[model samples]
Target: MARIMSGVQPTGNLHIGNYLGALVNWVRLQDQYEAYFSIVDLHALTGRPEPAALRHAVREVAIGVLASGVDPERATVFVQSHVPQHTELAWVLTCLTPLGDLNRMTQFKDKSQHQPDNINTGLFTYPVLQTADIVLYRADRVPVGEDQEQHLELARETVRRFNHVYGETFPEPQVVKSSAPRVMGLDGESKMSKSRNNEIGLFETADETMLKLRGAKTDPARLRKTDKGTPEVCNIYSYHGFFTGEVQRAAIATGCRSAQLGCVDCKKLLAQNLEVVKGPIRERAAVLREQPRRLEEILAAGAHRARAEAEKTMVLVRERVGLGAPRS
Candidate 1:
């Protein structure tokens, strides 16, 4: 089986968009591949968060992962910082990465535009660390969305560059495009993100999720319940494609165009379906949150397993680079 590695930044509460777009796929991938998932707290550092808040965010992400159906027993799940080889390899890869390539990264430019004052070196070199995260594990497949295609390309290039200099040290990771639906936020303007305050958190109560869905934006042209609207243009209808069955979605589309279904009732149906799917996950997350020590132990064990693989890779890397003491 191909080795798969991926991670999520512990920035804040993960929304339904995150669950459907990434975490849901991750759970399925774990059963199909040798998967390693991490709470990338290191990446979160670019924002310059408070230390205590960072710690909380890390734990919350881990809990979210567990609640979202990532079985620690099936897949290696840990904190990124727990395996030191990630950063160690990052430093080496950073040395080999071209400054011009880093400068060309679209994400870096976008982030700089967003937070002009705090455009630190760490932010610029984020993709290099991401390259380390993948190559360190010798992962052959990386599941990612369209937004992250550039980063994965960088990772593959980094692998080829390192192999050229260091001699066949890492496998070029390939992109496993997510089959899940691309989820939009309540605002229907941009991706569902915590910073935008448009997310329905994965672990939030069903009622809370329903409230957000009920208020979510639909087709702008549709003014009243009597107006016929295009379901294809509605963000809420896109969500229905994920949570609702095909027959139901067809019904919703027909109802929408016929002015037979009001937006409020349509959203209520979405909430009901979403709850049916997410209710178990919320319950699981609640239990995991309560058992803090169990969560810690799970992470500790995952770290131990990840360290074993990372150390083996590092040994080969060290020998290739001639960085360690000469063998007797």
Candidate 2:
């Protein structure tokens, strides 16, 4: 099976957008690929999160990953920082990466504007590290959302540059696009994000989920129960496309257009469907949280497996780049 690599930042609680966009697909693809799913704690450092918070978030995100059905038996679930080769390889790639290319990255520009006071070098060279993350594993396929397409392209270019200079050290990784690539937040203005405060947490209780849904944006034209509305324009309905079945989705759309169903009812239905998926995941996460030692053991085992593979790549990288002998 071809190897695939992907990761989620250990920033905060993952939400439904994460589930629909990445985690769900990770679960599906694990059996078909040599999957390496990582909780990228190193990448999360750009925000300068508190150390204690970061440690807690890492375990929480790992629980979310495991609870979402990414089996440790079938996939390598590791923390990014645990495998030091990631940053080591990142530095090598950063040297080869063009400043112009990094400057052109929209994400870097956007992030710089968002955190103007802390426009650190890491923020600018983020894509270089991402390239290292994929190529270090020699992952042939990378599952990414629409927002990361530019970064993936940059990764491909960086790989090409490395190959040209170093002579075929890595294969260009391909994109594995998520079915729901851009899950909009409840606000319907931007992508679902914790920073935006428009997300429904994956581990939230059913009542909490429903409360958030109640305030979610729907068809703007929808004024009263009697007014007809377009489901296509409604963010809630779009969410229904992911969580609700085809038959029910069609019925909801028809009800929406015909003025038979109110936005409140529609949101309630979505909340119910969402619970069907998130409830079990929340329960499993609870169990994992109660057993912190078990979570650590899984991560330790995964890091051991990941380190073995990373060292193999680094040995070749060191020889190709004329680095010093392997450390004792």
TM-score of each: 0.96, 0.98
For candidate 1, the TM-score is 0.96
Candidate 1 has an lDDT of 0.89
Backbone clash pairs for candidate 1 read none
lDDT string for model 2 (120-227, tens) is: 999889898899889989999999999999999999999999889988999899999898899999999999998789999999988999999988888988988899
Q: Mind giving the per-residue lDDT tens digits that candidate 1 earns over 155-270?
A: 88888999999788788898888986456788999888887788878877778987887778999999999999999999999889888999999999999999999999999998
lDDT of each: 0.89, 0.92
- RMSD versus native structure for model 1: 1.8
Q: Where is model 2 more than 4 Å wrong at Cα?
A: none
Find the 10 residues in a row with the least total lDDT in model 1. Answer: 319-328
Looking at model 2, residue 317 earns an lDDT score of 90
